[model samples]
Target: MIDIKNLHKSYHMGKNSLHVLKGINFSVSEGEMVSIMGSSGSGKSTLLNILGILDEADEGTYTLDGTLIKNLNEKVAARYRNQFLGFIFQSFNLINYKSALDNVSMPLYYQGVKRNVRTEKAMHYLEKVGLADWASHLPNELSGGQKQRVAIARALASDPKLLLADEPTGALDTKTSYEVMELIQGINDEGKTILIVTHEDDIAHMTKRIVNLKDGLIIDDSKVTQVRAKAENYV
Candidate 1:
């Protein structure tokens, strides 16, 4: 339920222009899982930021579930992002001093959800991520996997139509990574659209389709099945 066409993005660096995305065009349907693979400066993350509405592109047309997002102001964009997008970052992005449940509930709270209703929904997602027992624990008290799971729970608390993840398992061990992926996979299986930007080859393979980027352009798109894990060309 996402559509993009001829996307171009650039930045100003000391009066010179640095292109981040030359032109990106892609589509992702509802209930499908997709991954983006690319080297550093290849525009994968930039593209993700654009799709996630964290940043605006210089020129492009993006329709997220039929909402054209070309010229929306920051206020509008922020409101839409909160309502429609769920973001999972590589750094977990959890508040260090807040309990896991509180962190997950914070988003909804900011959105004006009442305490009782949001807390119940937040706890439900935490239970789904196997973090029910650790709801009262702070980030420092939880392991990396636990922290990421908390982040996952937070992302799911909004019941967002789209889940946008950037290197979701990058900070965890292999076993933990697999565990988190399994959690994300479960969400995807339940009819949520998932778009993950990861450099891991196996992670890309686990998705139904992979989009490869190079030099700020989409170079390849293909359907593939899961294979053995190997080092990805993240360069």
Candidate 2:
């Protein structure tokens, strides 16, 4: 559902320009689970930002589900982001004062969904992430894993076409990380397209495909033997 060709990005600091992405090209089909891997200074984050429409590429083209993503006005960009992309960050990004249910429903609220419908959909996704019983808890009241689960529920509340996860398990322990990956795998199995940016090899292996980046270039892009995440096996 994502197509990119000759994508280039750079940042200017004083007289020098730092190139972040250089002539990148790749395509991710619907229902594919892909992970982006790179060491420090790689263009993975920049690529993710461009894919999420959080940043613009200096050159080349990015077409998300057939729409050319280039120089979108803020209103149109926000609309496309809300309608087509769902984001999961290493930092859960939940509201501290908002309960899990409220956090999950916030996106729907912004979309102008009715209060009842928003609550209904939020709870449905919370249940899907196995957080139905913890809906009343605030982010601070939950553990790291629980908070991420709530965040996942929030991401899914919009039912967006693509999910972008940036180091989704970075803040969790190994067991918790595997648990979360298991949940993510199940989501992908249901036909949701997911693109994850992570530095961890084991985590990348959990995905169906891995794209390796170095010095702003995609050095390797290949399908992998997907490793099923079983939380119990980690310990």
Candidate 3:
């Protein structure tokens, strides 16, 4: 569902330029769950940003779900992002005052979906993430794991073609992280394409394949026996 070839990206720091991604090539197919693994300065974040269309690559070709992604105007990029990609961040990114249900409904609202329909869809996703009972709670009222579940529900509410998670379990405890991964695993089993950007080995192992990045390039790419996270063990 995603294709990238020889991607290159750099940032200028006064007189010097910091090369973030150099000659990087990556691809993820439909119905696949893949993890991009890397250390702090490994360029995983830069790659994710380019994949999410939040940032432009200085050089490279990216095609998502049959659409060529390059040099789009902000308006068009936003439209494509809403129509095709769902993002989950380490920080929940929920509006502090908004309840879980409201946060989940935000994307649909941006898509100009009707209020009633969006609300119904939001509730359905909240249920999918096992957060329907917590729907009325605000982010502050929920635990880290609950907040992430809400974030996951929000990402899924729109039914986007690709789900992009950036350090999804970064702020959670080990048990909570496993619980969250289990939820993610269940979603993948239902046949959605997912790409997770993570630095944790256990987190990466949860996915079907791992692509290791270093020095701004992919150093290793291989499939692994997926470690299924048992949410029940944590519960």
Name the 10 consecutive residues with the lowest summed lDDT in model 2.
Answer: 226-235
- After superposing candidate 3 on the true structure, give the runs of residues whose Cα lies further than 4 Å from its correct spot: 232-235
- Clash pairs (backbone) in predicted model 2: none
Model 1 per-residue lDDT tens digits across residues 1-235: 8999999999998989999898788999999899999999899878988898888889989999999987888989888998899999999999998999999998798799999999999999999998899999999999998999999999989888899999998998777787788788878878999999999987787778899999998899998875433323221
Q: Per-residue alpha-carbon lDDT of model 2 for 19-110, expressed as tens digits?
A: 99999999999999999999999999999999999999999999999999998999999999998998999999999999999999998988
TM-score for each candidate, following the candidate numbering: 0.94, 0.99, 0.97
Candidate 2 lDDT score relative to the true structure: 0.96
The candidate scoring highest on lDDT is 2
**Looking at model 1, how many pairs of residues clash?**
0
RMSD of each: 3.7, 0.7, 1.1
Best by TM-score: 2
Comparing 1 with 3 on lDDT, the higher-scoring candidate is 3
lDDT of 3: 0.94
- Each model's lDDT comes to 0.89, 0.96, 0.94
Better of 1 and 3 by TM-score: 3
Residues 1-235, model 3: lDDT tens digits: 9999999999998999999999998889999999999888999988999999999899889999999998899999999999999999999899999999999999999999999999999999999988899889999999999999999999998899999999999999889999999999999999999999998999999999999999898999999999999756764
Selected candidate, larger lDDT, 2 vs 3: 2
Task: Report residue 224 deviation for candidate 2 (angstroms).
Answer: 0.4
